[model samples]
Target: MAQCASCYFVFCLYCRMVYHGVQPCRLRPGEQRAIRDEYLSATPAAKQAMEKRYGRRTLQLLVDESLTQDWMQENSKKCPHCAISIEKQDGCNKMTCWRCGTYFCWICLVALKASGNPYQHFSDPRSSCFNKLFEGAEELAEDDHEFRRVLVRALPHLSHRSRPRLCLA
Candidate 1:
């Protein structure tokens, strides 16, 4: 038995069909649909168990990609130093870019001087982002909830056994 490099689906080299563990392969359309429906309706814990049993890393990558795309759509800021997109999950407007270590204000998108106190930007009335750290906390929370809902909808597709073939060869 060997695993497909692209999809990670195990198969017998000689038989050229998916390995169904110890059971016979159930490739009938009705059986497949029933299994898919069961998985889709499963609880989060059950889905997690399925991910662990099948392909945890793949499922995680899919979830991360979906979340990143959603974040990019909802939040409109890129890290000044690294150019990587960022979303302010919560807290004050002060943001530290995880990729480039650049400290910036989430609201004004200004890079804060490393030599001075970061909170000074918030306190200074002259700064555009002054006293605006928690400006949209409630709205950000609601956006987060929507993101999670989108992730949950995507999980079923990620966990499906019959996902599209990743490689032609």
Candidate 2:
């Protein structure tokens, strides 16, 4: 059988993320996590290996960044001068680099850290800036994004100057 598409899309029956030649899952939606979890526990060595290989935050980061692997996201080009893990705080297009504390405008992604809602339900500087920046590649859908909880789908909003698209914080 062809199997389910998501299985091939995300990972394999072994809980190992499928890099190539992966078949789809044969279970219901969201069943993979539980199955993968149980499967991991059943294998003591593999469970330890898996735990060493991943964690709650890192796994979520992988999901949030999506499998897309954008060049912009990989590097902190948001501030060419400072060049560190910078995040756009609320209030303006100014982004505060956590490492250097330098504020910059759209030249990269609008970062919404935890608690700072960039969307504001309407067009905000962060979202608007980002929307403008991503005006060209709006069609491209992010396969995944930073998922704190599967039940909640909150994402960081870009300022008006940014490519005008939602991006991982």
Candidate 3:
């Protein structure tokens, strides 16, 4: 017979099962806390083990669901053109959809013309987004500078003849 150091639950050395003469083994405070914490942070494989041991499948499912919802709310935005969820890690308000290739603003979610200069939307005094490229940006001006560098690299591939004429109307 051996005793668990933390919980002091008696167990058989050969069988490695808890020894309960008549009543079930009572969980100690530390053991209960450890089980709760393990269930909360367990991966898929670990969660299986916890489910078998603690029978907390429902609780674990709820926890996973809540975590996923919180993550989506904070880190993702829906593309205005295709309605695809986009996760932007860094850069300016301008976003290009990978699925549909639609250019749009991440801040206002307005779709921009693919044949026109997207930068003009930022510089035009008549536009709502004029001079507000870095508005409400957490990274400050550094993000805008990096975005400009990326745009400059891409400009060489675009044909000048395909550029759309700005309509004053």
Candidate 4:
């Protein structure tokens, strides 16, 4: 339930509906620009609150990305997989997809895949670097979990720093 921070209305921008027990919309729109606007226009208290809630890097990106979607439900909300719309229930800046139990937002996953270092908070939060390759299904793994573990441990230190470093091949 992302309040407008001004009106404090608990509306789901993704679904364009008012909230019930759950938000009635699931979307795939990008909310980078709205995040940025909110950040750029935030009062100090709001900025502090957001930073306290989302972390510095997240706060920055919240003010950076300039894309949006209307029909896709996960937009305007934090969804790391770009595929599911679960309620944002934690202040830790992580969202889990009830559809697949996938953790992290699609932006972070895409950033990581694109060499954007979106997982810095991992070390601060005691999360393993191996989350890099710990993706869904054996298909993302292909042959062996052993290889995936190895890749997760080593990718953070690699110079390649792209999908190739995390690729099954």
Model 3 stretches astray by more than 4 angstroms: 1-55, 136-169
RMSD of each: 13.5, 17.0, 17.1, 19.9
lDDT of 3 at 90: 63
Model 3: ten consecutive residues of lowest lDDT: 160-169
- Candidate 4 TM-score versus the reference: 0.22
What are the per-residue Cα lDDT tens digits for candidate 4 across 71-98? Answer: 1243234445554444432244444456
| Candidate 1 colliding pairs | 93-133
Q: Is candidate 2 or candidate 3 better by lDDT?
A: 3
Candidate 3 lDDT by residue in tens digits, 1-169 = 6899999988855436787443333444445545556676879898786564445544444444454455567667888888988877566778899899988887778888789688677788998898877665777456556645654554454345432233322
**Candidate 1, overall lDDT?**
0.67
Number of clashing pairs per prediction, in order: 1, 26, 0, 13
User: How do all models score by TM-score?
Assistant: 0.49, 0.24, 0.46, 0.22
Clash pairs detected, candidate 3: none
Query: 41 in model 3: Cα distance from truth in Å?
Result: 15
TM for candidate 3 is 0.46
CA shift at 131, candidate 4, in angstroms?
Answer: 56
What tens digits encode model 1's per-residue C-alpha lDDT throughout 1-169? 6998998988955436777564433334344444445455789998776564445554444445454555576776888778888878777778899888899888778888877798898888997877787888888888778867665665565545533333212
